[model samples]
Target: MEVLSLKVNGDTRCLAAAPQATLLEVLREELGLTGCKQGCDKGDCGACTVLLDGQPVLACLTLAALVQGREITTIEGLAPAHRRRCAESPCASKQDKLHPVQDAFDEAGALQCGFCQSGMILSATALLQRDDDPKRETIREALSGNLCRCTGYTQIIEAVERASDEHAGREHRPRAWEQPATEPAGEGES
Candidate 1:
């Protein structure tokens, strides 16, 4: 087994993995981060999307050992809960805020079964990074890679549009904790 160190979900972790293990296996079986699900296990599905150096990537095709000394973000890392997770904590960092794409997804009611939600969100993040506000056709082009089996795509597409609007306005709230559940445990606004 090789000891590979990676930054996952903002935490640096060293894990023991097989030299030839796929990132998916190491994530689901070894590290127990099941949010990155297995769909096609090939690059086609885009279901196992995660961020590599802040960009969306397919986890199944990535090599586990290759990510050492680099950052690997998984679905668990992108959840809305984390945006406000430590918001109230005394040690909260400014980056604790969710990416604007997440807030847009929530505002647009874009998810159905929520199966393709994470990949969709990350892809949108990547798309938005290149453009301040993308047109519907542009958003459609950006999301072409991710698949939604539930045909929940209409809502998903709308969510991206809504995200663009919210992001422009700067009042985006991650769907989770939109109305903080009576305030974060340790938060005091900076």
Candidate 2:
């Protein structure tokens, strides 16, 4: 067993993992982050895709020990900051907005069986993070590794495009979290 230290979802995690354990195994079995699914464990299927140091890598094929010092982001890590806050406090509002990619997926009806949703969303988010205004072809290339048996690639591509637009729009305006606090509506204009 080897002690592995990894930064996941903006937190540091240390755990003992088998030397040969893949990142997927450590994430699901050890850390209990099961958003990455196991399918065709040989890495042909993108079911176990995750971001390692801002690059998308197949978790099932990635050695847990090899990725110890890098930042790993899973599907759960893609949730909005508000959602995480709400999850931590019962009094927090539950009406938090979904991540742009997730919102696009929902609006486009991109997922069917939903097995590939996490991987697709993560891949698209990574791509958008790097290039907020990627062309459709670039999106196709970015998502080429992920395979969705349920919805094919039509709506999936559309979702990515929609997300790109949403991301671009946000770039033009400050998000609520980034903006300064505002007074009550009735008193602001006085």
Candidate 3:
């Protein structure tokens, strides 16, 4: 067992993991950070997305030892900050409100099955963080790595646009040729 120190969920944890252990496995097995799901163990699915030094990376393909002394942020780490604010008691709901990206997903109905929500949410948030007002092609390019089998792309794109608007306070949702349009209700029926 080798010792690996990684900053996870706002805390620094030194864990003993196997040499062949992937970062995703160590997070889930040793640190109990199950927020990084085990999907397609080969890194095809972005379910294991984690922030390495504030950048999105596929944890499933990362080595546990390689993350030593590096900052790693999981979905649990990047949860809407307001969600943790408690009243005098621990059960009180937060008042600061959800992050605009999260709220946009809800508003646009981006998540249907919830499997790819974490990856899509955080990756899109990262993109918006870099470019406050991302064009649809930019959003599409930034999110090309993630795959959502539920086919929520329309709502997901809408959610990203909404998030960019609220975060940047800029009215920049353009109907571009590269941007996909929502299918007419039931007209896509095969």
Candidate 4:
């Protein structure tokens, strides 16, 4: 067994894995991150997609040992929730606070069986990181590798577009704590 050290989801992780084991195996089996699915095992299906150093990569084909010093981000990493309760937070309900791509997927009804949702979301995330306002064709090209047997790609594309719109909107919108200040009550009545 080879001990590999890598950063995963902002945490340093060390696990004993076979030298030839795929990153998918290490992530799912050792790290207990099952979001990256095992579909084709040949890197063609894209269901095993993850962000390696902020770029989309097929975990199934990436050797765990080869990525020892790189950052690996699984689907779980993309949708982290703060420890605080929704009632105590000013952010929207927990669901809306999920990664924008995930929120877009949910809002657009882009997911059905959910087998490919993780990969699709990650792919969308990577693409958006590069282009905050990608055209439909760009969204299609970004997600071309991920195959969803149910949604037929229309909803997926729509989801990415929606996420892009939201991203743009967020850039213009103030933070939850930055709502426009209201004038003091009856201040002008003096």
Candidate 5:
């Protein structure tokens, strides 16, 4: 067993893991951070995405021991990170916070089945950190690595746009899904 010291979610965590154990196993099994889903177990699926030094990486493809002393941020850490950033602001609240991206995802109905959300959210978070006002195509490219079997990318893209708008201090446009569907002109009323 290899003893690894990992700085995760603003905390230092030391644990014993197999030499070949992936970060996904260490995070989910050892650290009990299941938010980084274990899907495909290969690099193809971004379900194991996590932030390594603020860049999104696939945890399943990363060896736990190789990341010693590096900053690791999982989905569970996002809200706490936001809370810390807003600590001195009046907007800071005592209640647990959701990262803006997470909130947007929820409000935009971007989640379904929820298997791919953590990775998607993390990807979006990283993207927003780099570009607060990303265009729709940019958002799509940024999240292209993460796959969502349920939302069909539309709601997810809208969620990213909403978060971007919120960060840029712009009014959030309602997501397409959030807009009430217009009834077909009443059959006789054309």
Candidate 6:
């Protein structure tokens, strides 16, 4: 076992792991950060997604040894990071403690089984960090690597949009289903 120094969230963690141990194993087993799920154990599924230096990566496919001295952000770190940021602002409320993307996911009903939540949320967070107002297609492209069997991608997209809108201080828009249906044009109308 080799000792690795990893900076996760905002704290530095030192642990011993095998040279071939994946980041998922070390984060979950050694550091007790189970937010990074072990889904496919391969790169096909994004269930093990984690932010490596503000970018989403497949933790199950990343070598723990290779990630030494890099910034790793797990789902568990989202809220704390947000809280630290919120300390400077007046938006730190008890009910609003979760990261905007996380809260938006919950509010938008973007999670079902929750197996893909961590990855989805992390991906969305990364996207929003770069693009504050991403279009639907952009959002879809950004999250293409992460797959969700439950939400059908609609709510997930909406959650990302909602988070962006909120971050931009835009007025909240009703969901597609919540919007009133338009009347069909009458025969007399051209």
Number of the predicted model whose TM-score against the real structure is largest: 6
Candidate 2 Cα misplacement greater than 4 A, ranges: 80-82, 87-97, 170-190
- TM-score of every model? 0.77, 0.82, 0.83, 0.82, 0.83, 0.84
Q: What 10-residue stretch in candidate 6 is worst by lDDT?
A: 172-181
Candidate 3: which pairs clash? none
Better of 5 and 6 by TM-score: 6
Superposed model 1: Cα runs more than 4 Å off:
79-83, 87-99, 170-190
Tens-digit lDDT track of model 5 for 158-187? 889999998899998743334546878656
| Model 5: residues with Cα > 4 Å off, grouped in runs | 81-96, 174-190
| Per-residue lDDT of candidate 4, residues 1-190 (tens digit) | 9888978987889989988899999999999999889999997889999999999999999999999888889988886645323425775676645787888888888988999999999999999999998876778789989989785587788788788889888532211223457888767755
Off by over 4 Å in 4: 80-92, 95-97, 170-190
Local accuracy of candidate 2 as per-residue lDDT tens digits, 1-190: 9889988887889999989999999999989999998888998989899999888999999999998779899988888556877767756543354676887888789988999989999999899999987766788799999989784688888888788777777432211223446866666645
- In candidate 1 the C-alpha lDDT for residue 105 amounts to 73
**What is the Cα root-mean-square deviation between model 5 and the actual structure?**
8.3
Clashing pairs in 5: none
**Each prediction's Cα lDDT score?**
0.78, 0.84, 0.80, 0.84, 0.88, 0.89
Candidate 2 clash pair list: none
How good is model 1 by TM-score? 0.77
- Between candidates 4 and 5, the lDDT winner: 5
**Comparing 1 and 5 on TM-score, the stronger one:** 5
Model 2 Cα shift for residue 10 (angstroms): 1.1
User: For residue 187, what is the lDDT in candidate 5?
Assistant: 61
